[model samples]
Target: MPGYGYVSEEQRGVVLLSDDAVIPQVINDRLVTAFASVTITNANVTGQEILPIHTADSQGPRGDESGWIQVVSARATCSEGIQIKIVLPVHFSIKLAPGQTYPVPLNLSIEGDNAPKSMRIHLDLADLGNTKRWTVSTGEYELERREWGSAYKITFLDYDHSVHYAMAFPPEGNCEQWPEKRCPVVLALHGAGVEASSSYWTESYRRQKNAWVLFPTGRTPWGYDWHGPSFWNIESALDALRLRPGVPDDLVNSVGVNRERLIYAGHSNGGQGAWWLLSHYPDRALAGLPAAGYVKIQFYIPYFMRIGDAYADPLLRGILESAISEHDIDLYASNMAGIPILARTGGSDDNVPPVHSRRLIRMVNEWSRKTTAANLSEIPNQGHWFAGVVDDDVMQSFVDTSLQNASTQGLSLPALPSAFSLSTLNPASSGSKGGIRILQLQVPFRLGTIRVHRQNDQWILNTTNVRRFGFVADDRQEGLQRWSVDGTNFDKPPVVSGKSYLKGEDGIWKVADDMLWISEERHFSTYGPAIHIFDQPFIIVIPSTITERTITYRKMAQHLATSWYLFGRGGTQIVRDVDVLDGIAAQYNMLVLGGPEDNMFTKKRQPGLESMVKFLPGGGFQIDKRVYVDQGTGILFLAPSPTRTRMGLFIAGTDADGLLRAAWTVPFRTGLQVPDYIVLGEEYGDPSTGWTAGDGAPFGGAGTKGAGGVLAAGYWSNHWDFDARCGYLK
Candidate 1:
C-alpha cells in the first residue's frame, strides 16, 4: 500500500509465496489497511497514524500443505528493528471499523517423525493473535504411518460395568500371534476428557509392535449426565480386556504374552492416569512409564481450581482430592513398589513440570534408597510434549531398560550447569539459618525453581521442591557442592548466549547472543543437576562461526536475565477480538481478557472449551478465565502494557494460585520450527482479576507505551498493522 491510493480498503483476495526462506508456498487472502505507529512525548510529530492491517482464520483446514502454512500478507515498517508481517486467511479483511476484529490464523507444522514435544509449530505471541508465531518445519523428513483408534470402550465383565473408548495398539509391522497363551494386556487408561477409544494412543499400532494393548475409559458419573468418574477403571477394564475373544484369561502368567510382553506407557494426560493404575494395582502392570505426571499432578490437585471443586464427590476421589488427579496419580506411590519403572519428562516443561517425575524418583530413592528397579530421567531441552521422542535417545533407553532392569539403577540425575543449580538454602528463620547444601549444577544450564529444605541433617535441594531443571550446558561443566550459607557469590554460575551449532547447521551456530546475562568465558567442573533459579541471570552460549565453509565453530556465549511481566497501559475493552482474546482467556490462565462476554469463560458453544479451561489452570497449559470485575471469587494481579490504551472495564480473576509452576517455549532450533522474530510469550500464572472503573480507556498516547503496544502487536508472518490499537492490558 505505497500510497498507491484509489483502492478503498475493501474485501479482496490474493495469493502469493510465504516470507520464510524455508517453505515458500503461495497463500490467498484479502487486502486491508492498517494505521499503526509509535509516538513520543514532547515531540512535534507525536499525533500520527501509520498502517494497521489484520487477519482472520480460514474455513476448515485451508492454507495447509507440504510442511508449510499458506500465509501471504502486506508488510510495512514504522520503525527500524521493528517490522510487521501479517498473513490473513479468511479472518483477515480490508474492512475493519473502530472496534472490529481481524482473526489471526496460525498453522504450525512438524518435521518428520519426532516425539510429541519434538519440533512442532508454536504461536510465540503474548496476546496470541496479534502475530503469526508458529512452527515451520523444514527438516529432513520421512513418511511416517501413525494409525490409531479412538472411542474404545472397556467392559468390566465380572461387575457388568463398561468403560467406553478404551484404547490399544499393535505393532506397526505385524501382529504375528504366539503359539500359546494371549498377548500381554496393556491396560492403558485414558486421561480426563480423553475417550479411551480414540486413535490418539494408537493402541492398534502399538499392538503391531508386540503386546495387545487395552484401554478402559472411566465410568460416567452416577447422577451427572456428561460427568465421568475421577479414577481409572482398572479392575473392570482388565476383566473386559481378558474377556476379549482372542485374548487370554491371564496375561502375565503366560510368557511371550500375545505378540510382545505387556509394557505400559502414556503421555501427558494419560501419564497422570498411569500413576493410579500402578499405585492401586501394581501387580497388574509389570513396567510403567509415566511421562510428566507421576507426582506433581497428584500433589497440586487440591490447589487446582478445576479439580478442586470435583473433590467434593467422595466417590470420585479420596475424601477431598482434586476431582481430576490425572485419574491414576492417586495410586502412584504403591506402583513404585517392586515395579520396574522408567520415568521421563522435560525440564523446561511448565505444564505438569518435570518435578512430578523427579519427586517420584526422590521418594523411591529415599525409601528404597536405590534406582535399581526404577529410574527417572529428564529432557531439559524440552517442554510439556515428548519432543524428539525416539531421537533424544531418552525414549529409546526407556524401551530398552524397562524391558531389562529387574532392579533399580539407583536413580541418578545428570550434572547440570551452576546457573540452574541452587547454591544455598537459607530457610525462613524462626529457628535460624542452616548450613548450605549447594545445588551444584555442572555447567551451561539453569534450573527452574529450587527449594532448600532439610534433607536429613544437611540442607539439600531435591526435585520435590526444585520443580524442574532446564539443561542449557552441553557435556562440559562441574557439579554441585555443599557450601556455607554465609559464603560469597551466593548466586549460581553464569551461562553465555551466542550462536552455536550442535549436530547440524552452517558451520558454527548459537542459541542466542546479546541475550546473555552471564559469561561462560571461565571454566567450571561439570556434574549432575544443573542449577536453575529465577531472577538470577545467566547466558546461553552458541556455536561460533568462522570461515564460510568451516563446520567446526568455537563456542560463542552471551547472557540473559530471568524475566517477570507487568501491564497497565489501558482498560480491558479490547476483548472484542473474538478471534484472539476470547479464545486465549478461555484457554490460558496467567492473564485474563476482560470484555463484554460470558461465553468466553464458559463451555456452551465449544465442547473442548471447558477442557481447555479445566487443564489450563493446572491440567498443563495454565490458561484461566475471562470475566468482568463484577464477578466475585477471583484474585487479581496486574502488568504493564506497552500500548497505552485506555484501561477499559476489564477485571482480572483469580483462577488458581500457584497452580502454574511455570510456562515457556524454547526458541526453535532450526529456522524450520518457526519463523524467526515472532512475538512469543508464555502466559503463565493463576488467572486473577479485579474491577476496572477507570475513565476513558487508557488511550494509546504519544508515550512510549502506545495503544498498539497494549495489544500483542507485532510483525505477523513478517508483516504488521497499525489500527487504533486499544484495550490489551488489564
Candidate 2:
C-alpha cells in the first residue's frame, strides 16, 4: 500500500462533532474545533488538509482577512480502515458580517507519509466530506440564523441557573447615524416543542421591514406559559441583548426603540404566552398577535385525565385549583378589553382546538361593551403552525395597522376606556408602562383585579384579592386628582409620600420585597419540600465525616452538574461545611447533603428543624406527634436560612440508605411525585424509570394504609409558620 487512502462505512458518514453550532458575539477571535474520523482503506495516511467552504456565492473574499478561514490544526491517525480519527481546530479571525448566516462546508485532503506535495490526493469520504457543514453567524439581529445564537446560562444569586437563548435582528437602514429615528420592536415567542434558539420558527418575521425582532428562549425548551421565573427570563434576555456588543447603539438607546409601538406575537404555546404577557402586563405591549394559542393550560392539556386531578379532598382540590387559576388566561381575558388584539387560529388544527381563541374573543367583547371587540381570523384548513396563518395578507395588514395606530398614541399607557377592568398576577411596579395609574400588586402569581372609573375630579377603584396595592399618577393628569379605593382594608385617607400615595398607616407605597417576591425567582422557596434545587445559585455543604453515603451524594452532585451542563451550560460549587465562610450563607442557599449525625451544619440547625419535623430518639421521623419508624426515611424541607431571612432547603436521610434515596429524588424526573416535603421509605425503583408514589412516604403511621404511602407532601406558610390549612398531608 504505497498510496494514502481513507475509508467510509456504508451506513455511516464522517462524524460532525459540532452539529448546528452557534457562534455567540465575541469581541476577539474565537477558536472553533470540529472532530471527524477517517479510516485508512489500505495505505498509511499521514496528514490531512481541512478546507472550509462558504455555502453562499455572494460571500467572497474582502480585501482583508474578514472572509478568510484558517485551519489552526489538523491531527489524524491511520488504522485498518476500521477506526481512525482526526481533530480539526480552526481559528476564525475575521468578524462575521452582522445579520448574515454563513454555512461553512468542510472538505478534507489526505496524504501518505512519503507522498510529495504534487502527489496529494483528495478523497471525499462517504461519512465526512460533503456531509458536514457548520452555520456560523454574528450579532443578534433577527431569527434568520439560529446557529449564531448561543444558549445563555443566567444564574440568580441564591437561586438556580436558568438556560435561555435569545436573538435580536438589526433595524433597516442606517439608524446609527440618525439617532433620533426609532424602530418598532416585535417580541416573538416560539411554540412548545420549538427551541428558543431555533431559526426556523423565527424566519417568517425576518420579512417584516424596519423592525427589530427579538426571539427569547423563554428559559426552558418547554416553559409553562412563560409565567413566574420564565417571565423574568424574558426580561433578563432583553436586558442582556440591550448591552450586548455589535448591536447598534442607536437601535438600543432610549430613542432607538419606539416602546409605544412594541408588539407581542407568538404561535401555539408562544401564542398562549403572548396572551399571558399581554393580560398580566397590559401596559407593556401596544398590541398583540397570538396565533393558534390555547387560552389556558387546563384547556390546552386536559387536566381531568392527569394524575393530580384524581384527588377528591376539597382542600386539596381548592389548593390545586387556586394554583391553576394563576395560569387560566380566560379568567384574565377581561384585562385585554382595552388593548388592541388580533388573535388567530388554524381551522383544522388538532393540537389545540380553535374554539379556545373564539372563547377568549367572546369573553373580551362581553367584558367591555364600550370598547371595540378584539378581532379574530380563522385560516381555513390550516394547521397549528404559523406558516400559513401568519402569511395571510389580512394578518399582515392587521399588524401594520396596529403598529401605526400605536405610534400615533405615543409611548405612554393609553387612557383606559370607560368602565374598564384589569387583572394581574404577581404584578411588578417596573412593568407599569402606560401610566394608567390604577393598581400594582406585590404577590407573585396571585390574581388581583381592579375596576376603575373617572368622575369629575376623582377616580374610583373597586379592587378584589389585592392585599398590597398602590396607585401611580402623573401630576399632569387632570381628572384622577384623587383615588377612592373600595376592596382593601385601607379605609382611611391615603397619605401622600413622594410620588406615590400609601394606603392607611401600615401600607407602604414602595414595592413589597417579601418571601412572595423571592419565590418568583425560585418557586420552591414559596412552599417547600419540593424545591427546585438546581434553579438557584446554591452551594452543597458536606460534613466532616466521610461515609459511603456521603461519597454517593458527592457523586450525585457531580452527576447533576454534568447533566445540567449537557442540557444547557452552568454548574454550582460544592464546599465542606467547615470551609463555609461567615456571610456565605447570606449569599448562597445551602444544600446540606448528609444526615444530622454526620453533617454538623444540619446538626446546628436541628433546633429550627424541630418546629417542622422532629426526629424521634427511638428511630423514626415525627411530625405533629405522628411517628414513622419501620422504614429508613429521607426528609426534604425548606426553612428560614439560619444566617438571614432568605430560604434554605435541607435534604437529609435517616441513614446511608435514606441519603442515597434523597440524592436520586432531587432531580425533577424522579422527584415529580415528591411534593413540598417528603419522607421517603425503603421501597425504591430504578432512577431511570419515572417516579412511583409507593416508593416514598407513609412508610409507617404517617400515611394512610390503603392510599399511596405519601407521608407528608405539603407547603409551609409564607412566613415559614406551620399551618395545617395551607397544605394537604397524606
Candidate 3:
C-alpha cells in the first residue's frame, strides 16, 4: 500500500477491492520476485507470537528520497509438522539510512496450532535489491546461505541479529544430511567489495573431493578487510558449524569441519587477509593459499603522501603507528614456519604486483627451518584475475597433499621441531607455537621474539623484549624437562598439569607464582589503543536522566554506533546507566559517555580513577596535575574495568561541545591511532579525519580535516598506571 497504487476510476485516491496493484516508476518493469527468505524455527515449549525483524542499511536514501523502503510482510504457519505459507501485511515502509541499523518491526502473531514448538517456518519477500548478497553458489556443489547470531553485537548496517555466511558442501554430498565423517574445510575470504554470493569467488577454486568451502560476508562487502571485527566473524561462523557459541545446537549436529585440516585461501584483499590470519592464527590452519596478496599497508602504498609525519614528533608517530603494526604480515611470518603455504601472483599485474607474493615467500623461507614449507607460483603474461590462479595443477596437488597429511595427523598439532622461533608484536592477536605462548611484553607495540633449541639434554630458550612467557608440557613427552632461559636454569617436571610460567625482573627470569589468567597487569585481552575496545562485545553506557548534556552524550553514542556499522560491520548496544545492572557492567567492556555529574555509572566509579583522572565538581577535569576547565576540551581514555577483567573506555568532556569534539578521535577504520588515552582540544583540528582506506593512511595521507587536534596522548603502563614516559602533555 505504501509504495504501490491502483487505477482510480470511481474516486480520486481510493482503491476498490477488485483493483490491480501498480509498481513504482523507479523500479520500472524489472523482473521482480520474492528473492530472500528468512527461516524462523520455533524451538520453545509453546507457540508464541513472533515479530521478525529486518536490518536496514546505513547508506540511507539520498536527495528528495523519503529515506524509507517498502517491503511486503507475510506469516508462516505450520499445520501438523507441515509448513503452510500465508500472505499478510501487504506492504509497509521502514526507515533505511539512520547512520546505524535498528530493528524494523514486522507484524505476525503466531497461534499454538499453527506454530507449535520445534516448528520451522520462514518469511519471504523481495528486498530493495533483488539479489541475495549473502548467497554463494558452485555449479557442481550445493551451496546454501546460513545465519547465526553473534556472541557479541556487531552494530552493522542491518538490525538483523544474525550474521550470514555462505557454505558450499563437499562434492560428495551435503555434510548436514550425511556427515558420517568429518570433512576438511577451506575458510575462504572474499576481496574488498566482492560479494559473498559471487560465483567467481568459489567456482575458480579447485574443489577437493571431500572438502567444504566457507565464505564469510566479513560483516559487509568491504568490512574491515578481514581484520578486527571481520576476523571475529570468521571465528563465529566456524563456531556455528561446530555448535559452539553464538549458534543453536540443532543447527549442525554431526561433526562437519575437520578442526585439524582447516585451510585458509583468498584472492586480492582476501589474499592479504589469508596471510594475516595464517600468521596470527597459525595453529588453526594446516595450510594457506594466498593469491594476489599484497604486503603490509606501509609497503603496499608508501606514506610519501603523509603531510604530518615530516614535522610530527617521532614518539607520537611511534605510539600512533603501534596500533597498526599487526597489519605488517611479515612481522609475524615466523609463526607459520611449520605450516605449509602456496603463494601465487600474476607477474604482469600492476595491482598488488608480483613482488608482494615473492617477498612473502622469501620471508617465509628465510624464517623457516623447513625450507620446503612455502612455495611461490607466478603466472606469466597475466594480470590480476586469471582462470588458473588457484585452480591449476599445482594448486590442486597442494590441496590434495595437505589434506592427506591432515588425515594422518588427526587434530593434534604436527610434531613440533626441537628448535624453532616465535615472533610477535601483539601477543593477543598472535597464536602460540608448540605449547609456548608469550603472555606479556616488556614494551608494548615492539617486536618480541623467543628462540628455543635443545642441546645436551637441556632445553635452551632466549627471549627479546619479553616480560612473561609460559610453556604447557605435552602429555606424550615424559620425564623432567631441564630449561635454561636467558642463562637461568630451572627444572620442570612434565606431570599431568605441567604448566610453567616465568617473568623477567631486572634482567633476571624468575618463576612467577601469580597465575597468568588472573594477573592484573595488562595482558592479551586487555591491551588497548582505544579502538581495541570494540574487539569484544561492548555496551554504550549513557546518562539516565534526560537533559541537554545527556542528549549530546546520546548523540555521540549514536555516532559511534553508526560509524561501526559503516566501517567494521559491528553492532552496538546503547543503554542508560539506570538500565545497566552490576552483572551487566561486569560482563561487558563499557563505552561510558558523559562525566560523573551526568552519568551515574561514572559517578560511582570516579573515586577509583581519581588518582589518574578526576572530574571537577562543576565543569572540566584534571589529569595528574594538569587541569582543563575549557568547554572545548575533551578526554578519552581506557581504564581497567572496576567490576571485572574487561576494559572501560571513558568518553567525557567539560560540557556537550567538548564531547562532540572528542567523538572524532574514536577510530572506526584501520588507521589513525588514539593510544590508551588522549585529550582533544578544538584548536588545530581533529586528528586524522576523513576516508580511511585499509592502507595505514587516511585518504592517502595523515588526515587532519576535522575541528580539533590531539592535546595530549599516550599509553598506559604495563599495569594500567599513568607513566610519565608514555604521556604527552601540551
- Assess every candidate by TM-score: 0.30, 0.66, 0.74
Which is the winner by lDDT between candidate 1 and candidate 3?
A: 3
Q: Which runs of model 1 end up more than 4 angstroms from their true locations? A: 1-163, 171-180, 203-208, 220-232, 245-262, 294-298, 302-335, 387-393, 400-730
Better of 2 and 3 by lDDT: 3
Tens-digit lDDT string for candidate 2 (161-273):
32234656555443232224566667788887687655566565654555567777665566545664455566765654444334423434532554434678888888888
The alpha-carbon lDDT assigned to residue 401 of candidate 3 equals 85
What candidate 3 gets wrong by more than 4 Å, as runs, is 1-100, 103-161, 171-181, 243-255, 369-372, 411-418, 456-458, 472-480, 493-500, 504-519, 624-631, 684-708
lDDT of 3 by residue, 379-428 (tens): 88988888888668988888878866765655444554567788887776
lDDT of model number 2: 0.50
lDDT of each: 0.28, 0.50, 0.60
TM-score of the candidate numbered 1? 0.30
